[model samples]
Target: MRYVIIGASAAGCQAAETLRRYAPGDSITLISDEFRPLYSRPLLTYLLSGEVSPDRIWLKEKDYFNRWGFTPLLGEAVVRVAPQSREVYLASKKAIPYDRLLIASGARPRLPGVPGEDLEGVYTLRNLADWQRLEAGLEGVRAVAVVGAGAVGLKAADALARRGLQVTLLARGAQPLSRVLDATAASMLMQAVGAMGIDLQRYSWPVAIRGEGGKIKSLALNHDRELPVQAALFSVGVTANVEFLEGTGLDDPGGIVVDGSLRSADPHIYAAGDCVQPHHLLTGEQWPYHIWPAAVDQGRVAGANLAGAGLRYRGLLPQNSLSLRGLKIISGGLGPHDAEDCQVMTELDERRGRYRRLVYREGRLVGLTLVGDTENAGIYMQIMAQQLPVQDLAADCRGPDFHPGLLWG
Candidate 1:
C-alpha cells in the first residue's frame, strides 16, 4: 500500500513513523512546504530569546527518513488533492498517487489586515523562516509593539523583553489570555509581565501601522493612542491550511471535521493536527485543539487506523503550558470562568506568587489552572483525562500539600 502524508510537523511526522512501524514494507511519503528539516514550532520563541540552540530545535536526525525507509519530499507545497483520482498534486506540477492520504497540513499565523501591515518591521512568528527574519531584523529595534495577548503574543513579548527591547503588549480583551485564564490568574500573569518591564495594555489593538521609508514608525491603537516603535509583531492566532482540500468536501470553517477514527468524509482520506477538528474529551465539542501533544496523539491514532489497526481516537483535551520569565503556568480543560456549572476551589499565596484553581463538575475534576507551581500538573491532567471523581480530595487539591498518594492510597 502507498501512503502519502501532507505536512512534516508533529502530527504528520508521528503518523509517518506509526505507519512505517505498522506496515513495515508499505511505501510511505512525507511532504512538507518547509525546506528545513522537522523542528519544534513551539521552540521558536526560545530560539529567539537565545534560550535554546539552533541544533536543539530539530526533532529528527539527519538520517531520519533514510533510517525509516520513507520518501521525504521537502520544500514542496500540495496545491490540491483529487479524492476521486486518489492523487496529490504539488505546485511544481508533480502528482503522487496514494492508497491512503493523511492531511496534517497544520496552520498558518493569522495576520491583522491593518494599513501599513506590509511595512519592513512588521512580522509574525509562526515558522522557522519568520523567526529567522525577525531575529535578523532586531539589530536596531529598540521598542517592539506586540499585538494580541494570547499565548503566542505573550511569549513573543517575553522573549523580546529578555533581549532588552522595550515591549508593549496590546490585548484586545481586558486581560491577557482572557479566553483561557480566569480573572485572578490573569492578574497574576499580568504582574509577572510588569515585573519583566513589559507594558501590558488591555482593551487595545492596532487600527493601523504607520511607517516611514518602508519601515515601521508607530502603531495607532483603537483607544486614540499611538505607540512609537521600530518593530511590530502579531501573534493573534492561526488559521488551518485547508485551502488545498477545497473541492474535496472535507473542509469546514473551524477545520476539517473527522470521526472517531480520524477519517474524513472520504474514507480514503484522513486528517490530524491543527488542520482537523476532533471531539473534545471533556465537553464533547468538536474543535481544533492546536496543541503539540494532541497533534502527536492524533497522528499516531490516524496512522494506526490507516494501517488497518482499527483504532479509535477518544478525543482531544485542550491544554497549555507556558512560562513567562520565571513564572510557570499550566492550564487545561474548561476553566472556572468558562462554565456556569463548574464549582471552583482555589489556593493562593500572594507573597510567594503561587496560585491554583480547580474546576469541578458533577464531582469530577474538569479543569485546572496552576501558576508559579506546576509540579503536579501532570497528575491533575491525568485525573481530568480519566474523568476521575475528586470530591473526597477537594480539600487536598486546594493546598500545596496535595499529593497523588491521597487519591491512590
Candidate 2:
C-alpha cells in the first residue's frame, strides 16, 4: 500500500505512525508546507512562556523519519489534488500516486481584509514561525494589541504579559471566551484578567491597520478608537488550507468533508484534523473541532482504515482546558437545556476567588464550569459524556463537596 498524507501536523504524524505499524513495508509520503518538523501546536504557548523548549516541541525527532522508512517532504506546498486518480501534485510540479490519501492540511490563521494587513510586525501565533517572529520583535516592545479573545489569543496575551509587554486584548464579542465559557464563567475570568493589569477592549471590530516604514504602528477599531501598538498579534480565527482541493473530490467547511469512516465523498480519499469537519458525538454535527484531541483521534481512525483495517471514527466531545496568567478556568459540555427542574447549582466564594457551577439535563451532567476546584473536573466531564445521572450533583454544585464518590447515582 502507498500512503500519502498532507499537512504534517498532529493528525498526519499519528496516521503515519499507525501506517508504519500496520503495514510495515508500505511506502508513505508525508508533505508539509513548513520546513520545521511536526511540533505540538498547544505547546507553543508554553514554549513562549519558557516552560518548554523548542527541541522538545517536535513530535518525532530526526531518527523517527529514518526508522519508519517513510518519505518526508517539507517546505513543499501542495498545489492540486486529483482524487479520481488518487494523485497529489506538488508545487514543484511533482505528482505522487497514492493507493490511499489522507488530507490533513489543517488550519491557517484567518487574514482579515483590512487595509495594511500585510504590514510587518503583525504576527499570528499559529505555528513556530509566528512564535519566532513574536520573540524577535519583543526587544524594546512596550505595547502590543492582540486581536481576538479566544483561548489561543488569551494564552498568547498571557505569555506576552509575563514577558512584561503591556497587552491590550481586543474582542469583537462582548466578553472573553464567549464560545467556550458560559456568560457567568466568562465574567469571573474577565475579573481575574483585570487584576493582571492587561487592558481589554470588547465589542470592537478592527477596520484598518496603519504602518510606517513597512512596520505596524497602530490600528483603528472601526475607524474610531485608534491605539498605538508597538506590535500587533491577530488570533482572529483559522480557515482550513483546502484551496489545493478545489478541483478534487474532497470537500470541507474549509477543507475536506468526510464520513464516519473518515472517507471523503471520494472512496479513495480520507481526511482528518482542523481542516476536515469531524463529527461531534454530543451534537452529532460535522464541523471542525480544531482542538488537539479531535485531531489525534481522527488521525488514528483514518490511519487504521488506510492500513486495510476498517475502523469507524467515534468522533469527539470537544474539550479544552487551560489557565491564563494565574487564573484556573475550565468549561465543557452543553449546560442544562431549560433551567427549570434542571437541578442547576452554583457556588461562589468571592473572598477566595473561586466559583463552580454544574448544570444537568434530564438528571445527567451536561455542562460544568469550575474555577479553582479543578481536581475533579475530569470525572465530571466523563460523567457528562456518559450522560449519567448524579444523585448529589445539584447539592454538590450548591457547595464544594465534589468528592468523586458523591458523583454516583
Candidate 3:
C-alpha cells in the first residue's frame, strides 16, 4: 500500500513516523516544499535574535527520511489533489499515486490589505526560507515596524529589540493578545513588553505603506500618524493552505473540515494540523485549534486510523504559552469573550508582576490564565480537559500548592 502525505512540518512528520511504526511494509511518500529536514517552528524567533544558529533549529537528523524508510520528495510543491483518481499532481508535472492520503499542508502568514504592501522591505515570517530572506535584507536596517499584536508579532518585535534595532509594534486593539488574555492580564504583559524598549502603539491601524524607490520608508496609521521604518513584518495571523483542495469535494469554508478520526468526507483522504478544523470536545461545535500540540496529536490520530487502527480523536482544546523579558504567560480553554455566563475570578501581585485568573460556569472550571508563574498550568489544563468539578478550588486555585490529585480521588 502506498501512503502519501503532503507537507513536512510538525504534523506531517509525526504522521509519517506513526505510519512507519504501524505499517512497516507500506510505502510512505513524504512531500514537502521545503528542502531541509523538519525543524522547530517555535525556535524561529530565537534564530532571528541570533541566540541560536540555523543548525540548532533542526528537530531531526540530516537523513531522517532515509532512516525512516520513506521516499522524500523535498522542494516539491503539490499543485492539485485529485481525489477521484487517487493521485496528487506536483509542480514538476509528476503524479504520485496513493492508496491513503493525508493533507497536512498547514497554513501561511496572513498580511493585511494596504497600499504599498508589496514593497521591497515588506515581509512575512512563515518558513525557514522566509527567515533567511528577511535576515539577508536586514543589513543597515535601523528601525522596523511590526504590524499586529499577537504572539507572532510580539515575538518578532522582541527579537528585533534584542538586536538593538528600534521596533514599533502596532496593534489594532487596545492591548496585546486581546483574544487570549483578559484586559488585566494583557496590561501586565504590556508592561513587561514595554520595558524591553519596544514602542507599543495601541489602537494603531495601518492605512497605507509609503515607500520610496520601491523600498519601504514609512507606514501611515489611521491617515495621520506616520512612522519611519526601513522594514516591516506582517504577523497578524495565518490562513489555512488548502487551495489545492478547491474542487476535491472537501468542506473548506476557511479550513478543511474533518471528523473525529481526522478523516475528511472522503474515507481514503485525511487531514491534520492548522489546515483542518475539528469539533470542540466541550461544546461539540467546530473550531480550529492552530496550536502546535494539537496538530501533533491530530497527526498521530490520523496516521493510526489510516493504518487501520480505528482510533478516535477527542477534540482540540485552545492553549497558548509565551515569555517576554523573564515574564511567562500560559492560558488554556475558553477566553473571556467566549461566553457571557462565565464567572471570572482573578488575583494579581503587582510587586512580583504575577497574575492568575480562573473562569467558571455552573460550578465547573472552563478556562484559566496565568502570568509570571505558570507552574500549575498542567493541572489546570488537565482539570478543564477532564471537565471535573472545580468549585472547591475556584476560590484558591491560584495558590502554589493546590493539590490537583484530589480530582482523581
Candidate 4:
C-alpha cells in the first residue's frame, strides 16, 4: 500500500508513524508546506519569549523520517486532491498517486478584514515560519497588541509582556475566555490577567490598523481610541485548510465531515485533526476538536483503520487546560448553550481566587470547569467520559473528595 498524507503537522505525522507500524512495507509520503521538520506548535509562544530554544522545539528527533522509512516532501504545497484517480497534485505541478490518503491539512490563522493587516509587523503565531517572520520584525519593537482573548492570544500577551513589551489584549467578547469559563471563572481569570500588568481591553476590536513605512504603528478601536504599538499579533481563530479538497466531493462544511472511523465519503480518503469534524458520541453532532491531544488520538485511529485494523473512534469531547499568570484552568464537555436540560452547581471562593462549576444532565456529569485548583480535573473528566452516575456522588462532584475507587469497584 502506498500511503500519502497531506499537511505534515501533528495529525499527519502521527498518522504516518502509526501507518508504518501497521503496514511495514508500505511506502509513505509526508507532504508539508513547511521546510522545517516537525516541531511543537504549542511551544511557539515560549519561543517568542525566548523561554525555549529553537533546538528544543522539534517534536521529533533528527532523522526521524529516515529511520521510519518514509519520504518527506518538505516545502511543497498540495494544490488539489483528485479522488477519481487517487492522486494529490502539488504546487510544483507534480501528481502523486496513492492507494490511501489522509488529509490532515490542519488550520490556518483567520485574520480580520481590517485595513493594514498586511503591514510588515503584524503576525500570526501558527507555524515556525510565522514565528521566524515575527522574530525578525521585533528587533526594535517596544510595545505590542494582541487581538482576541482566546488561549492563543492570551499566551501571546504573556510572552510579549515577559519580553518587556507593553501588551494590550483586546477581546470582542464581554469577558476573557467566555466560551470555556462561566461568568464567575472569567472574572477570576480577568483579575489574574490584570494583576500581571497587561492592559485587558474587553468589548473592543480593531476597526483598522494604521501603519507608517509599511510597518504597523497603531490600531483603531471601536471607541474612537487608537492604541499605539510597534507590532500586532492576531489570534482571533482558525479555519480548516480545506480549500484544496474543494472539488474532491468530500463533505466540507467549515471542516471535512468524517464518520466514526475518521473516513471521509470516499472510503480510501480519510481525514483527521482540525481539518475534519468528527461526531460526538453523546450528541451525535459533528464538530471540530482542535485540541492537540484530540488531534493525536484521531490520527492514531485513522492510521489504524487505513492499515485494515478496523478500529472505531469512540468519540471526542471538547477539553482544554491552560496556565496563565499563575492561574490554572481546565474545562471539559458542554458549555453554556447546552445547559437548559442540565443541573448546574457552582462553588466560588473569591478570596482564594478559585472557582468550580459542574453541570449534570440526567444525573450524570456532563461538563466541568475549574480554575486556580485543577488537581482533581482528571477525576471529573474520567467520570464524564465514561458517563458515570454523579447524582449519588454529588459531594464528590461538588467538593474535593473525588474518590474514583468507589465508581471503578
Clashing pairs in 3: none
Error (Å) of candidate 4 at residue 197 is 0.7
RMSD, one per candidate, in order? 1.4, 2.3, 1.6, 1.8
Candidate 4 per-residue C-alpha lDDT over 1-409 given as tens digits, one digit per residue, 9 for 90 to 100: 8999997888888898899999999899999998866889999999998989999988887688899998999899998999999999999999999999999999889999999999988899999889999899889999899999988988889888888888999999899877788888888888888988899999999999999999889999998999999999999888889998887776474789888899999999999898988887557798776888888989999988889788888788889887886899999989866777877878787777778888877767788888988888898888888887755435564455644444332
lDDT of 2 by residue, 1-409 (tens): 7889997888898888887889889899999988866788898988887878888898877676787887989889999998777789999999989999998889889867799888887888888888888788878889998898988988888888877889999989888877777677788888877777789888977799999999888988874889898788899889988888886656454557788999888787888888888776666777676888778888899988888689988666767687875688776775333344555678788777777877766657767778866778888778877767677564644654557558678
TM-score of 3: 0.96
Cα lDDT for residue 210, candidate 3? 97
Best by lDDT: 1
- C-alpha positional error of residue 129 in candidate 2 after TM-score superposition, expressed in Å: 1.2
Q: What alpha-carbon RMSD in Å does predicted model 1 have with respect to the real structure?
A: 1.4
Off by over 4 Å in 4: 251-253, 396-409
Query: After superposition, which runs of candidate 1 have C-alpha atoms over 4 Å from their true positions?
Result: 404-409
Question: For this target, which candidate reaches the highest TM-score against the unseen true structure?
Answer: 1
* Residues 1-409 of candidate 1: C-alpha lDDT, one tens digit per residue: 9999999899999999999899999999999998765799999999988999998999988788899998999999999999999999999999999999999999888888889988999899999999999998999889999999989888989999999999999999889988789988999999889999999999998999999999999999996999999999998888899998887788675789999999999999999999999999987889776999999999999999899999999888889889987899999999556668877778898999888887877877778899998898999899888887665545676555676445532
Q: How does model 2 fare in lDDT?
A: 0.81
Worst 10 residues of 1 by lDDT: 400-409
Whole-model lDDT values for every prediction: 0.89, 0.81, 0.88, 0.86
Residue 372 in candidate 4, Cα distance off native in Å: 1.3
